[model samples]
Target: MSWSLKIFNKFPINLSSSIHARAFNSKAIGILGVPFDKGAGTRGTDKGPNALREAGLIDEIKHISSNIDVKDYGDVHYELMNTNGRKIHNLNDLSDVAACNKALADQVEKIIKDNRMPITLGGCHSIAIGSISGVLRTTTPDNLCILWVDAHLDLNTNTTSPTGNMHGMPASLLVKELRSNWPTIPELEWCKADLSLRNFCWIGLRSIDYYERIMMEQYGIKYFDMRDIDRMGIDKVTNAALKAINPNGDRQLHVSFDIDSLDPLFANSTGTPAGAGLTLRECLFLMEEVHRSGTLSSMDLVEVNPLVGDVRDVTNTLNSAKAIVCAAIGSNRSGNSS
Candidate 1:
């Protein structure tokens, strides 16, 4: 890498522009908005990326430092047709969902090629299959670690899902061979499906179906449930998650934080809210921990729906979102900088 493109390069910010498409002027942070919500069986989450951006996240990121280049790539475009004629267990209009995810993967791959950290603002948790696949394609398979922070296990496949929601499938797809289930979906096979299950970890989980639980145990994916959190404390649990996700591996880290991981009171806007979830402070501490780890190569802050809540819900979501981003790029000399 050239000295000018080094991670510490200094860059000025222009408040008004899409941050992902333009050539990064410094150690650029690329922002791509995935606005499709059919994955979640909800209408409002489609507005997530725009709402977060309109909440002045760019300005907040810029406020952190002048050396960081933040670029917005705008939202993924997908035409939503009727749900008629879709496969029985499939939630989304499968064809449309596949097309949209392909676009998402392509954009993410481009951002990674630009040598910038892709900070994706998501419409739903399902976008992970695309974004993570893109990153995993560019990065070595053996060096990939995914940190999934959510209240729900999200391990349901089409065969196990009662609601047939694709949002519940990303975690499983990330760790399993999803192409067999969605055989006709070309996008699901964008990368080789022979990836291992050893590099995944889940935190803040309070909800899990029986089938999902069995899968977690079967794969031996390290998960810190709510009870575990109460017993071990956030500091210890967070460290455990970090250690499990990386596992002495050479791969970089990618964190997928579903805002629904926050308590229902704090994240009422999301479609599926678990009874008890992480508090605002715990979530922030988790983000701070990720920042301190110094291995976070990309991040996705997802599932913020402004349409379902009052100003307070919106305010909490906005504040939580900002706090999480700050945690990811926190100042030096804080926490564990390992």
Candidate 2:
């Protein structure tokens, strides 16, 4: 089962063509794949990056426009941490998670230094610990805002998390508000708590843990769950989210997009499938809006495990992921100017 990429000629969301014309750039994009999945309990998410690539993702992105410069930086590499007799309670594979994220952070920064927008393909949501950290290195938390699109708040600490999967705890690792929640884990010393929770906003959160909800309330974090979308609608909801996080519209924007944000009907291959998630068009519109912002610094598209479902399921998930990437890179449904 294979998939084809197509941009509709009549996209209903008219954010204005002038904006797209001015916003569209010969943007140089660097593709970096973090194939490390130690942060997740699932075994196959590490193959996500290559799965999309093998499905003609890069070629399709290149076909978006002649001016679009896309470079494949290839996959990130890291040393596997040997935890000989060392273990962290309730934190699964801390050593490997730390080791891989450290390397990922380094590469993300390098991509930025080269003036290419970093487009990261992830092993899981935990890869965000590195992607977000790398973006933080170039700008201050005050000047950066992360728009996290997922089914979960991802705000749990090791002790608060029922499952020790580091994927569930990346947000806590990077947020300053949750700094007190974590105990000293020597393996993760390189990863710091830098970004504040206020700098983060979430979308498509329908499956939040108890502790995560408590933390969200305590921090007054702004989020638009599926219920909110069901009310205000995706367009208005997306605009509100942009205004909330980047009110001034000048901050560096980093979007951590988890495929599980989409309903299982569209993305059933992911390890975590939340029902009544965003539709494929809705997710595409969000990416389109992100591109229109022109402040998109980097993005992490994660959690499409090819090994989790049947052939058709894997193909659908990959195609959805590829379409989102294309839209982010300036492929308009109204068609590109070039």
Best by lDDT, which number? 2
Model 2: per-residue lDDT, tens digit, 16-115?
4312222322378899998877788888999999999999999998888888788999999999766676887898888788888989999999998888
Residue pairs with backbone atoms closer than 3 Å in model 2 (clashes) = none
- In order, candidate lDDTs are 0.73, 0.84
Q: Model 1, 163-250: lDDT tens per residue?
A: 7888887777766544455444444445455456667777888888888877665555567777777766787777666665564434
Model 2 weakest lDDT span, ten residues long: 1-10
Q: What is the lDDT of residue 236 in candidate 1?
A: 70
- RMSD to the true structure for each prediction, in A, is 10.1, 6.8
Off by over 4 Å in 2: 1-26, 81-84
**Model 1, which residues run further than 4 Å from truth?**
1-27, 78-88, 177-187, 331-338
Candidate 1: residue 33 lDDT (0-100): 93
Candidate 2 achieves a global lDDT of 0.84
